[model samples]
Target: MTTDPQTLTWFKSSYSGNGGSCVEWAPMQATVTGIVPVRDSKAPNGPVLSVPSRSFAEFIAGVKGGAFSAT
Candidate 1:
């Protein structure tokens, strides 16, 4: 389930350029609820995907560790 984006502060990696292919997350809410809110940077008002904190963290770690291949 998703929540009102207006009530949350969203952010993406600063290292990520403004290529419009980035993902934004609401860290504030995650700290309180242990659920991560993810949304497309290209569509702020679009649907938000809520993921469990542990799962989200593992996914991020996988990304950083290059566990996924772009191809």
Candidate 2:
């Protein structure tokens, strides 16, 4: 499914730290496609990662659970 980048309502995850390093995603779009499109907010026109919705959920759960230690 082709999606117009401009139409995507990209939003950063609440888990994102205040630091500059962060990723943004479009939740509404993900629900429809079963794929979550994510990109670096600092580079709006940059490449995007389209992951399976289930995988995205696992990733978020890991983040919230602090499975990955802060560097």
Which candidate's lDDT is highest?
A: 1
lDDT tens string, model 1, 1-71? 55588789999988779788999999989998899999999999898999999999999899999999989
lDDT of 2: 0.87
Pairs in clash, predicted candidate 2: none
- lDDT per residue as tens, model 2, 13-66: 676788968899998889898989899988899888888999999987997899
What TM-score does each of the candidates earn? 0.90, 0.85
RMSD of each: 1.3, 1.7
Cα TM-score of candidate 2: 0.85
Candidate 1: residue 10 Cα off by (Å): 0.3
